[model samples]
Target: MSVMTISEALHEALRGEMLRDPKVFTIGEECGFDGLYGVSTDLEKEFGDKRVIATPISEAGFVGMSVGAAMRGMRPVAELMYIDFIGVCMDQIINQAAKMCYMTGGQVSVPMVLRLPMGSGRRNAGQHSQNLESLLTHIPGLKIVAPITPCDAKGMLTAAIRDDDPVVMLEHKLCYNIRGEVPDGDYTVPFGKAAVRREGTDVTLIGWSRQVLNALEAAEILEKEGISAEVVDIRSLVPLDFDTIAASVSKTGRAVVAQECVNRGGYGGEISAQISENLFGALKAPVVRIGAKNIVPPFAHTLEDAFFPNTADIAAAVRKMMREEGSACG
Candidate 1:
């Protein structure tokens, strides 16, 4: 194993997958060069234009082309510079790539991956800084995965490329520079699996992508207050590992789900509802959700910090949940 940043691990994964499968190619804007967040840096230099094809600033056009290529049995990894731009190509992604396989009575498969750089903390403002994974998770045909660490970033990307259906891989911009130990050579992390980052009995903290790191940090802080918080990372959202989350909540008797997206319709709410529905008797308190405010991501750093849920917010949510005596009545 070698220690590397999430960016480097992603680059290594793309490089390895391209070499392993001649049909696997990447198509997106600025991907042929250094790429946004350095995940595709030096990829085109090694693989050339045929494999690492660069396109114009047309999200709908290029993504439509990627879907067509995937239908023809070619694995295309399309990069959307930001998750916010998904609106420009919703028809291609939600309608075409997602529905083709099922529409053809399972005779055809779209083995494609859409890589998106998401989340806030950078001053990218309202347009560029948004976590829209919840939108994709709502779609029936699409699969969603968010890697919090370098190891999973590499492994999950490899797995997404090899899968038969279209997968949306959400990479947090803040996690690109974070370093961790990643295994050498080709490997894949299976979907519908949850990784327990910390073990405890007091309360369960669940999150994905950068929010997982925040949950981990919150667990550490809660430890000082005599609260043993267990942290679970929901790596894949679509084929969600509800079993792991239910098990954790059952063990802890309380749960607090956190995410960087707005609270109203965030995926964290779905997690909370699932826990409540499946493990109501096991819960000592209502499942709380910690998420960003119901407002656009602000440009100012101070406002941005307040808008997004932080380590303190997670810890506080857990504390509130623990204070309850039994499951909340509807």
Candidate 2:
């Protein structure tokens, strides 16, 4: 085991994959040295330019080029810098890369990982900070993975690189420097498996990415108020682990889903609806959802705090569910 930040762990993971397979290569804007996070800084020194290629300021062109490379049997990990720019290359992702295998009768596979830095809390304002994972989930054939820790970032990136599909890896902009224990060797964390960070019988708190950390933090705060909240991290949004979610909701009889995106048309609605549809009988209260406001993220820390959901918001939601559960019982 090695203690490292999420950035270092990603660097190590990419290096390991590049060493294992010659087909694995990376491309992004200024990813080396002074790149956004320096995740591939030292990688170029080891692998040279052909493998660690950098591109011009063209999301559409580079993303399309990566999709083409993937179709030609090369594994490409293309970094899009920010998730807010997903619109710049939506057609390439949605029409070409995502549907290539199905469109070609399984003859061609788009094995690519798009590293997207997302979510607010860094004062990046509306243009730079947005949790757009909900949009990608609506589209079929695209696998989305959001890792929370250094270990998870490394393992899931490994799996995403190996998968024969177009994978969107959403990296929360605030999680880059988070330190955690990561394995020094090679490993892969399979998709669709939800990790239960806490066990409780009062309510289930479901989230992913940085929101999951808020869930865990809220769990601790709730515990102080005699509320036992269980935290479930839906690591892979596309291949959802509803079985685990269902079981947890069944055991708790209440649920609170959180998302960093706005509440309106957010992805949390899907999880909340599933609980209502499948476990309606077991539910003691309506599934509560906590998320950012519908307005754009503000640059001010105070306004951004108000716009995005946090530990306090999550705890309040769980408390409301507990009260509602009591009322339903009565």
Candidate 3:
């Protein structure tokens, strides 16, 4: 086993997949040189121009190309530097890549991966930073994976690359630096499986990507406050692991869903609703959510901090729920 940052793990996975499959290719802006975040650095050199095709600043064209390639018996990884830019290529993603398999009656499959950096932090502001995984997941036939730890980042990316369908892999910008232990050899973590990052008995806190780190921090604080809070990292969103979430909520009788996206219509809302519907009678407290305020991410650091959900907000939500139950609290 070796410890690595999430970014490094992702890079390693991409490299491994490229070496394993001759048909596997990656194409996107800035990938040929150093990649946007260095995720594809040295990849072009290793794989050559034929496999690592760099394109113009045209998300639609390249995404369409990926779809075409997949139909022609090739697996492609298309990188969109920032997920906020996915709107530029919505037609190809929603109309072509996502619908091809079902629309063709299983005659064709789009074996492709859309890799993008998402979430707010580093003061990138409104245009550059947005948590739009919910938007992608809203569509049909697209598998979404929001990995939190280095291990999941490596495993899930490998899984997405090998999947028979198109997969939207959303990497949290803030999680790039977060370090964790990962196996040195090749491994594929199954999509739709949720990992219990930290287990407790009072409240279940669910998160993915960068928010998983925040959830872990909140769990530590909750422990100090004498509240046993279970933190679950929902690595996959589209094929969500509702079983793990329901089990955790059943044991704790409370749920707190957290995410970097804004509160309104965000993925957290869907997750909370699922818990409420499936485990309504088991819940001692209403399912609450911790999310960014519904507004464009602010440019200023101070304002951004206010707009984003943090450990303090998560801890407060858990405490309030525990209080309603008359559970022992600090």
| Residues 77-196, model 2: lDDT tens digits | 999788998898999999999899998999999999999999897899989999999999999999999999999999999999999999999999899999999987989999999899
- Cα error of candidate 3 at position 27, Å: 0.6
Candidates' TM-scores?
0.97, 0.98, 0.97
The whole-model lDDT of each prediction reads 0.91, 0.91, 0.89
Model 1 lDDT per residue over 95-179, tens place: 9999998899999999999999998988999999999988889999999999988999999999999999999999998889999
Give per-residue lDDT, candidate 2, residue 116.
94
Where model 1 places Cα greater than 4 Å from the true spot, the runs are 324-330
Q: Which prediction has the highest TM-score against the true structure? A: 2
lDDT (Cα, tens digit) per residue for candidate 3, span 184-236 = 99999999889998889988999988788888898898888788889999889
In model 2, the Cα lDDT at residue 28 comes to: 82
With a 3 Å backbone cut-off (N, CA, C), the pairs that clash in candidate 2 are: none
Off by over 4 Å in 2: 328-330
Clashes of each: 0, 0, 0
